[model samples]
Target chain A: MEKTVIDAHNISKIYNPETIPVYAVNNVHLHLLEGEFTALVGPSGSGKTTLLNLIGGLDKPNEGNIYINGTDITKLSAGKLIDFRLHNIGFVFQSFNLIPVLTAKENAEFIMLLQGIKKSEREKRLQQLFKEIGLEDKTDIRPSQLSGGQQQRVAVARALASRPHFILADEPTANLDSVSASNLLDLMEKLNREENMTFLFSTHDQRVIERARRVITLVDGRIASDSAAVPTSIPHEQVVT
Target chain B: MILLMAWRNIWRNKARSIVIMLSVAIGLFAGIGVLALYKGMMKSRIRAVIDSEAGHLQIHHPDFKKDNHPAFILPDANALLKKVQSFPAVKMAVPRTLAQGMLVTTTGSAGVQINGVVPALEYSASQLKRKIIAGEGFHEGKKNEIVIGKKLADKMKLKLGAKLVLTFTDTADNLVSSAFRVAGIYQSGNAPFDELNVYVSLTTLNEWLLTGNSFHQIAVILKNDDDLQVMQDQLKKTYPSLLVQSWKDLSPETELMVKTVDEYSYIIMIIILVALAFGILNTMLMSILERTKEIGMMVALGTAKAKVFLLVLMETVFLTIAGTPIGFLAAYIVIGYYQKHGLDLSGMGKDMMASFGFETTIYPSFPSEKLVMILAMVICTALLSCLLPALKALRLQPVEALRR
Candidate 1:
């Protein structure tokens, strides 16, 4: 049985449709299935992040319906959309935006707390996640005390802490050095393999694109190419879409 | 966790937060200090009225207070005085023979309230002997001795032993005159009272009026202030025909002054809190502006708008709570110290204060009950102050804010 986590149809986001209109994301259709390690790759102004924002429910599209796990997120109210995102979607930003004042563990537990998870359950999950992310010792350290790669790892842990249906990461490794970026990709790939977690990243890094089982290219808010149809690198665990 | 985050967030800009906290502390300190001072001054005035001028309770003939007419004297004032004196709470009870008269000297004449009092009992009621600045009080077994205020003595250009003639209508309505020599000059700090009042021997005044054993009023002083209203109610029940009144009833102006001071204290506190509120608003707004990206991240991470508002509100509360204890402790120490030692304003001019019937030295009294209201007002102010900044945080779009 295949579960389609995201099914966005004819989504078009215009910055200023009334005056001096700019189509940030124009007339695009995208679908992501459960347990798919996919990459959304494009040059600057090619609308990779914009499309990601639309699918992540961070921004509303001017036209078209976005269904996340059978719920039309585009029709949901602002407050409902936020709750939907909280339960079903995890976001990883380019800057690894962990709350500066909170320790890495606190940041990771933030989403679960918002979900009203009991302390015992949150602690159990946090212990497993921190150990899996290789940050068990760094859990008490604030983001400022951690390196770029460590902070990104913390962000990843925070995203997974809520057990969202899927993770949407935008340029997750842009700020990291080559070694840190490679290490982060390796950790993300490991999570994708072992935990069967779905990851959809918008990035310019070829390293990220190479590891992605299926790559989707966006050109000016339209899907230019999708490797989902053609079988790519991973012969085993084929994309179910 | 939101509370912890809010608490830690205030310390991000330590200097700014400290500045706002210090503003709150200093504002409350000054406000509490001024309130205590005003309370002290008013309390002193009220005590003076009750203890020195109008004893805690007074009983008079129904018509006596209407015009101080000598003919309208209390029918059995001595009996009433004895009864009042027997009460356990009664410290002293004295009979007064009041007459409206004119005092004439060679150089000038003035209208005066001639209070004919038994020196021994009057001294116990008013402590008037301590106020005498010149000569001794009425001599024992004195025939025709008078105690006039220093203001009256100065206005008439008269010294000790100077003769003055007092003329008033006697009981039969015939005008009668008597000559008296001034024995002592006293200054009671109240200029108006000093200028208008004179004291004389009760026996001598009765003889002059040809009204034997009759007095206009009986003044009662109590041992404890807490017994005032109860004693007054009891006395009122005992003397149904006569007019029995408490000091508040006798001196409505002092009572009004006390109420006015209370209203003014609240107004002063509100103004100070409002000023401190503005400081809090500005600081929290700046903090929100600086953390736009961070706040947007939290919002995007499914932190509800209500939670965001709470976080900002809690930050302001933390700042205010941090400052409040310092303010209260400082005020307590200063007010407690001065409550015993007194804060002297004599350097500002004793005459000015005395003219207004205020003591040169004031003892500050901080009512413990007021702290609860002050803290409630401070918390309300903090909430009001944080509203704008919190709304601003709520209005943020995660996509746009993260762009910043």
Candidate 2:
């Protein structure tokens, strides 16, 4: 009964459409309600990342539409779409894409700065997020100075800074060791439960999939399965390969 | 924050940035130093011509310039000289009798332009008194005394105190001749001028020619050369029937040289700036290429394309702003030192410079206004150099760039 935060209707993306056409995302219909922690899982080249990109307005879909909080972002101009993404959606890349020149606090506060958030409010939110991510003492450290796990924690803090409707993380745990991966998932789950923060991840890691409340499996640019899962009941050996 | 990112990014590749900055500085230094030296040479040439030959302004009977005939003479020449010297801007004025004649000696004979001058007035009006390299200057009450150039003396084989005869037509169109003793030998450092000119006392020339105090030309020097045009205009108004001319009119070649040096400086500046622009472009492009992922990530996080373009531009501006002042300061120190102790071109181009009426020692000078102009040009070059790289940053697609 929670309000639907994302509504995607029959969207398709075709790559190399002029010659030897490849359909990267084909006629996918999906929706997520508020507070849903969802995972899009598929093997390599199965269109998991493509679907996430289309939903986040990072890539354009060739047909149909994607709606975030009932706004059709597929109809927006490139410039407007960037602004929309800034205010409405957060993104975490697999490579822990923090601007290497900026300190952790500056990186976290960057989106809010783009959104023209006042400095005092940005400071308040940045401080709270850093403490929540256990990186309070690492605020002045640049990405290069931080460990991989600490860097990813700062990336998560950046994503949460603007308090967007949802965050789309693409293979967020791909570069982390098991302990770092576990810690990141735990942090994300904690933010999801306590803050009702909606998240949609394109991941093949079993650790991530087991933590998601909803799992949508993709095969050959189409949804092969959509199911609900109990986090503790999902088997570790059943990770998408 | 964007500025901070741009500033920090320049230092990320310290060695590369420093190399580019140094290239810009060196190019600018070379361009400015060469321009200053050329300007100094032109200035020195102009000063030499104005001081030794043409005064700041000249007044002549309209018909006298048409031919060397002695009939065309300024009426009341003494009154005109006194009136010209009364002006506050007029530092000195002197009247001269000019004749194109032949100098004859026992050993040789050659053509010459005879200038009749009063010793004290001529000394104040021209630097000829200072240029006497051998023998003393004219003596008071000495009749038929002459000052001739060393080159002329050498050609005629006449030494100081040697007797020579000058032959020319008088005002009545009757041929006349006079004997004079060379009392002084001068070397004006100008080969052509020194080769064909001699001076005699105005009183002696007047007595011999029976021209009775009439003058062919009146030369006036100003306390400040900037008043040349104003004084020329005033003289023209005062003597409407007389032909009044400034140094620019009397010596068109020196004026042309000034303009040509200005134009050549601009051309050289453009060439240097173009070279510097290439260096800036290469550095900026490399910086942008290496930060492709970072730029992509910024755009994906909702930084506007304009912001990305500005970021690259800011980095380029910072590099130029840091380098330009250093270049200008270094040039200032070098040119200042040379301006105090002249840069000697005697070993390099003494004959060439002397032929062109320039001194062997040049004082390099840079005008403050020109310094401002060069700084503005450097900043403009930086802006122009950043365009292509900034456009490249604008063309980046967040999706594709992130993948790269």
Candidate 3:
């Protein structure tokens, strides 16, 4: 039994609570062990993003608690929760939100810089991540100068720079073409296998679901199914070519 | 890294940033330039009054200022003048016999103030000779020679060498009339002063008044104007019976002008700063609004709310810092040029300025102290302008901001 990295217990988030209430995330209980590549998949407006936000401590749940590495993050203050997220969790947005003014290397090193990592160590890790993402020559290029695929690669590198306990990616490949999407998934899979890095993604793309080892389906603000798949047995017909 | 990002972010919207900077620079220049002009005018007026009408300090018989009667005269005037001249700070002291009288010529008669001055001593103390516009100044052997203002001469329809009659009361309270010839006509650039004052030799006026050697007033000029208050204090302490006054005390209107000009400059500065603050606020707010998502992303990545506030503040400060010095430099150059050549308002306000004893041309001057004050004011304006936008940045929630 691997150590549990995330333990969420009956968390609920209600939007517009008083007038015409909507349950964005309703009483969801979930947990993930270390080194697992999990995917939260559902149709549009099914609360996948809301559940991910709760688990990452970006938003507070109205009821119940979320624990990351046995720490009850739901009880932390806004400031402390931010600090906790900085050291314990990484996030990748769907829009590839890289700071436009910074170069790729600066973007990748930004998280470590915030964490007070030493200058030499930040530079070394940034170089290794850029090389691993096949963006060694693009270190000095700003986000505007890079292609969409290259920008997403830089975003991924930034997420991995701090070596967090788990990474949460929200529709990470939504904006990418098939070729770029396939390359990104392959890179993430390689990182997961070699480094035993844990990742949780909220995605509707079948390509992402196929690569994920564990799939949790959400429907109408509740978890509808939870199952594990054999990595080699994914149907190629369902993957977007 | 935050500072670098702020700097780069300003250039992201190059046109907008430049517009804001130009507005600030132009506003500051206009405010400072107008203040310099007003200050220059006040300074010129004060200098004219001090050098021509009132010396650095003056002493008079305590009763003489209440009434112009000849009996109210300073006793031992010559000895007092000698003693005052001996002081190191006192450059020169000239005794004058003053009388309120009437001047009569062939065409008309007009009221005037008679100033009896010794030519040789008055030349060193008052520079009256340099101001003579028509006819030669007083000659060494000349008697009953008078120097009348051009306005007075024009009013009386009198010319140089023309005989004029002065009528006044003697020390015995009897009316006496004396005849004198106008030796020179002087124009002091002050219409009111030029229209009412006439000068003659003290020897002639003393004989006519039958007052012997007594004088009504003693005007003292100092080597350095900074020694005015000290010398006035010493003079008052020495001659407790007499009244000693500095130029500012004698001319309250000019002093008021000096004080009010400073106050008005600050008011104008505040108004201009308020206008600049609005421009800065608008630009900063727009910049923050456009980068809402980016700011959210930074906060989500663990940048503190305080750091986000600082980032916006730094952007405003950078914008102000870049433009303020340029405004100051431009104002300095303009004021410097006018200080050399003067800004000619003669064509516009010749009569108005002349009545107030100010020259037609004003030389603009800006002191180093005022520059420091203006810079401080600009910094304060920049900080004030950043508050609203910085607060807006601080209020952003990472979850909602990212969604936007």
Candidate 4:
């Protein structure tokens, strides 16, 4: 009973506007099934993050279209696209973009604030999320007061605050240590199973890719391979298509 | 929540926010201080003229604005005085005869303009009784008595109860003479009002000026100074041919000068407001520039660009609200203290002010309208200067911002 939540066709993106263009994403096609834990991986300049940006409605593709949950985001008006991104696509970034002035709870409640959700409901939801994320004690503290890993955890909570259908993480673990990265992957894997949330990410770290049910590899702005991953990690063997 | 966030954000940048508030407060204090001082002082000077020297309105032989003539007179003083008394705002109406004359004694003779008034009625409408430095105001229902300026009394070698002779052109321009006991001497602070003016009984002046009980124009006092225009308009409507002069028109040059100076002050106020607006704009713009990355994140987090714009605008409006009340209080305090005392210009500018007919000490006074106008200027400039910051916040590209 798998449903396709995202479909990409012939999506090509160019960073350079010149005649001799640099392709950030080229001739890439992807479809993420409902309730799937998918990871995208490649080296630097390999277009993994570019592919995620195109799918997440943060950027436009130069030569193709992207559909999220069956609606073409490319056709949505700017305001409606923002609403779409707010409700259906959650994003976690490498830098953990928490507002320095706001507390962890406020950051977690940001999407609900944008949705015009009532404050009581937003607060209640934040309390539940804070409890689950092991950040109940840190909820009232500003991001500047928190460590890098704690800030990233707050970012993850905020991304999930709106109950989005898909969560996009770009190098979410790059700034974390080995233990922190493992803990974040476990949290994502649990959310992917219990809440039936779809997860897509771009990373070079094996800790993240190891938790994915499916992996998409990008090479030179093109998709090199798309395949399912073994549930258990083979510590001795490198993952290859 | 948005308002709360805006409030918290302002406190987070306390230094910048405080600087903006201080600028607005200073501007408002100066503007309001000037307004109060001008209004209070002007009222005092004008009231002095009305109660003591000039009645609220004047009626003169039409040609008197041109020159004095023994022949120029009102046809019937009793009848016109009755018509004037019918008006409710006329606190007390009186007939006065005026002529160019000379007061002579053994020691000296000096040129004078004699005002002949019914003394009892003049008492009810004037501060003359209080200003008398020697002797007393004209006796009630009596004759052969006169009051002269303090300076004039000295020149004529006259003392209280000293008999003085007055000579003037009679109805036919013939020189005639009369006599009076020196009654009182008064000073109105102006050398011109003090030195050359005289008051005598209306009956005696009628006999001296000689036009068979036909009197000069009737003067009036109104209950409220503000009612001058309304009363004048009503009086004009009631008697179209009767010439009426309100105090403003009676002192047209003084009125014109007050308005001119007020206009100049208003122009200066506008320039200060413009400068303050620019200062606010620069501060807000700098803050926006510093928060660019944060604003970009808000946009990338699926915040509507319109909301981004609104959030920035709300931050500015919130700051202004927080500051403006404090500014208003500061302005009120400064103006209130100065308005209670007065600005003493006596050291250097007193002589110049006296030459220009302003008092030695200038005090600030103004109506509520001026205060409201200044408040509006401060608030509008602060809020308006926030436009550039709001626009900058709105024009973000989510993808590029996320990348940054």
Q: Find the candidate with the highest lDDT and give its number.
A: 1
lDDT of 2 by residue, B1-404 (tens): 88998899889999988988888788888889988998888888787778888888888889888887888888888898899889999998888888888888888788999898888988767788999998897999898899999878877888989999999888888788899998999987776788788999987887766789778888888999889888888989989999998889989988998999988997898899989899899999999999898899899988988889889889998887778877888888999999999999899877677777778899988756588788888889989999999999998988888888
Each model's DockQ score: 0.77, 0.73, 0.58, 0.50
Estimate candidate 4's alpha-carbon lDDT, on a 0 to 1 scale.
0.78
- How far out, in Å, is residue B391 in model 1? 1.4
lDDT of 2: 0.87
CAPRI classification of candidate 1: medium
Candidate 1 vs candidate 4: which has greater lDDT?
1
Off by over 4 Å in 1: A230-241
The C-alpha stretches of model 4 lying farther than 4 A from their native spots are A228-241, B60-70, B82-88, B100-114, B118-205, B212-214, B254-265
Q: Of the pair 2 and 4, which is ahead by lDDT?
A: 2
Which candidate tops TM-score? 1
TM-score of every model? 0.96, 0.93, 0.91, 0.84
Residue B58, model 4, lDDT: 72
TM-score of 3: 0.91
Report every candidate's CA lDDT.
0.89, 0.87, 0.87, 0.78
Q: If ranked by DockQ, best first, what sequence of candidates would result?
A: 1, 2, 3, 4
Tell me the tens digit of each residue's lDDT in model 1 across B7-42.
Answer: 999999999999998998899899899889998998
Where's the lowest-lDDT run of ten residues in candidate 1 chain B? Answer: B188-197
Show the colliding residue pairs in model 3.
Answer: none
